[model samples]
Target: MCGIVGYVGKRDALPIVVEALRRMEYRGYDSAGVAIVDDSGHLMVDKRAGRLENLDAALAAHPAGSFAGTTGMGHTRWATHGRPTDRNAHPHVSADGKAAVVHNGIIENFAPLRAEVEAAGIEFSSDTDTETAVHLLALEYDGGEHAGDFIGSAYAVLRRLEGAFTLVFTHADHPGTIVAARRSTPLVVGVGDGEMFVGSDVAAFIEHTRDAVELGQDQVVVITADDYTITDFDGVSQQGKPFHIDWDLAAAEKGGHDFFMLKEIAEQPQALADTLLGHFENGRVVLDEQRLSDGDLREIDKVFVVACGTAYHAGMLAKYAIEHWTRVPVEVELASEFRYRDPVLDRSTLVVAISQSGETADTLEAVRHAKEQKALVLAICNTNGAQIPREADAVLYTHAGPEIGVASTKCFLAQIAATYLVGLALAQARGTKYPDEVAREYADLERMPDAVAEVLKTGPAVRDLAQSLADVNTVLFVGRHVGYPVALEGALKLKELAYIHAEGFAAGELKHGPIALLEDDLTVIVIMPSPSGRAVLHSKMVSNIREIQARGARTIVIAESGDDAVRPLADHLIEIPQCSTLLQPLVSTVPLQIFAAALAQSRGYDVDKPRNLAKSVTVE
Candidate 1:
């Protein structure tokens, strides 16, 4: 996961590139750099192998007016081909320093290509695969006279390389032009007046303009100061499709909050309500204008939900609900591993692909594979009109607007809510539940926004508990039933935010193997099931808490209000509004989010942009 930004415009490229890198800090990086074509046609490059602040410090040490250019490219790199060092950082330059390139995605055949370049007497400077690309371009240049000749040579060089990548290059000879190309990786062009921008994603230029262009497969774009041209590998000119981004620059900002996570945590009430709105109309759940008949749903034999990381956890929770409501066998698979194992599928099988950003590469590929196998693919996506949604047979959009933080909070809740709605719709269509029964479940779904609001009110206490545990080296989460996935999400948040060694295990599995890790210094966060319909689950989890507390483990209990049985064992008790067992994940995940955010903040870490992590996984 790397971030790339390029600008060819009238404004000074330094400040714009630097600010865009800051916005992309959440995408995780070990180094930052920028290369600019100055007004006098000199290629000026500055790079450092640390956080953005380290780059800023280096820029401050140089003279104020040292570098100037109207066009440039910048990159924040997550090391793949080399270590995190200045020489290995992005914006790799040619031996003659005439061409500068910033690249994302891995190059599978860089070794053989490097051998060929060395055989031709070309010298290399860095260990990055990107350096091979620049040197290859330099060899192809051959001191070309026409711009088209140089462009054609660059395209020829790219044709020899293998593996996924998005490349943006600037030549000193063409002072104001930037050449960009992508294959299997994301690249977007931002349109502006008398200016053009290229980046790995749309967030890079949201402050400048909302207008953007999506680059399709094997397309190349040459952007100049006043215009841009798109072409294919065979030198045929092509056209670009324009897309309008709805979120403004303000949504990417923290709005004076301590961190992006905290601001996002506070935005949950509105986010949940926004996701729930318009789903219930005329006593039925409607999904993105696609209506399914009872026969269509009843004919389904099996269901599979595929996702990665937090989205996978959401699918785990969905499996419980969908199986209960529809009386169908459901399996949840990690999207990255789904296609490799040759999964069993048929016409009657339904595949649900869950992703907050529908651009996740592996999940998108899995969706495509499922469709090829003749399975009906339904996408539970928060992003509208993304690749996954376009490929799926149907889509249920989660209206949790723009989650900028790397660690997911509101989107997880929204995914659960959306998956629950899908389950209810399936049950209603199959006549498994009466209209009144579906109406009753819809009432529960409607109350979720307020229930989520009530759970958020417990953040203060959770924050206090987090501060007390900030010094603890290890934390463990244990739960049963639906609380099991909640525990996994809790541990994931802790690891993502606090950078601590944490593990989540089912409470029943603790004694089987994980109990040995629990000791005096270890803090255990247990999600206690509500003492309502799932009395067995509630009693079992309370007993598990007691078992761990007897072992000298500090217990942090997240339980429903008025649950007196669990109070005695709780070292820190965080209350949640009572809801059905299937919907408990919506409320149970709140305290975990607050705990992780506050703990990370207390340790002087950036909770929103956590170390070595990006907001989306666009590369496989």
Candidate 2:
């Protein structure tokens, strides 16, 4: 994954480009660089191999803002083509130094292209496939077809590259212009009165303008200080569709938190509320994916949920809710492993695919595989107009706006909310629940926002406890039912941020294998089962807590406020509001998020951008 920003504006381009890179750094942080065509016709590029701060320091050391110009491009690379080193960073230049290019996405045919270019006596300075594109662009620019036409030369180069990419190129001679091309990967263009901006997402230019255009596939855009033009790969002009970004700059900022992850965790109450809005109609829950008629729904016999990482956990939770409410057997599988297993599927089956970005490679591939089996596919995604939604039979937008943190927070909550809607819709279709019963469930969901807000009030206490537990080398979590996924997610958060050994297990399986890991002073966090409707699970979880405590382990129990039984046994008790057992995760998950961020911060690590992770996984 990588983030790109290209701008042609009257304002100071250096600061604008740098800030855009910072905003989209969640996309990639392996390395960063910027290329600007200076007023004197010198194309300059300055780069660093580490975090964006290193590049900022490098720019600050220079007096001229490290490459000031009116037209420029920027990149944050995740290191697909080469090792993340100074020489292999983005904004690579050609041998003659006339052309510079910043590229996102992998080039499948870079090997042969590199060999042919080298055979022609063109020397490459870096190991990245991106450099090969710039070299080929220089060769194409010097050709007789369009020797001095920057956009034409760029279009010619795009015609040859055979992979997903969003490329930004600039020639020294074209000091007042920049050319950008989009293929399979996303590229957004922002429109201003006397300026233009192009980026991988709207966050790149949200600080300057909210009006933007979503560039189509296989299109080329040429931008100048006062105008912009668009064309197809074969040179036919096309109209670019524009839309306004609903969220403003405040949504993207940290709002005084040390990391964006912390602020996003605190914003979950509102995010889930937004996703829950406008779903009630005719005294029942409704969804945007109304393509399925009730007759079609009754014809369905099974359900399959496919996802990856955190989305996979959400899918697991969905399986429990869907089966209990719709009386249909549901199975959840990892998207990466779904198609490989040759799962039994048919038109009678419904496949629910969940993703925040809607561009996850494995999920998208899984959708195609489901269609190959003629199964009805439904997508639960946050992004509008993403590839997955367009390919699916129907779509349910999560409406979680923009989540800038590398680790998912608000999107996960919104996804679970969307899954609840899907469950209610199916229940209504199958006559499993009466309309009034569905309305009551919808009312319970309507109350979840306030529940999440009440949980947020415990952030300071959870954070301090997590900071105290930072010295522990390993953390373990256990749960009985829906709490099991919350346990797994809690462990995942600790492992992701604290970089420590962590694991989650079903409370019943403690004696099977995982219980052997418990020892003196080892921390075991328990997501206590709610005592409302599941008294058996509550009693069983209390027994599990006693067993772990007997092993000389420190127990941190996240229990409901009135659970006096677990309080006596819990070494450190964390109270969450009482809610339906199935929906307790929406609140139990908040403490885990805050604890992970605090523990990682106490260890002096960057909680927002973890090592070897990107916000979106564009490649399989």
Best lDDT among the predictions, by candidate number: 2
**lDDT agreement with native, every candidate:** 0.86, 0.88
**Candidate 1: regions farther than 4 A off:** 61-64, 143-148, 235-239, 289-299
Q: Give the distance in Å from residue 19's predicted Cα in candidate 2 to where it truly belongs.
A: 1.5
What 10-residue stretch in candidate 1 is worst by lDDT? 142-151
Q: Which ten residues in a row have the lowest lDDT in candidate 2?
A: 59-68
lDDT of 1: 0.86
Clashes of each: 1, 0
TM-score leader: 2
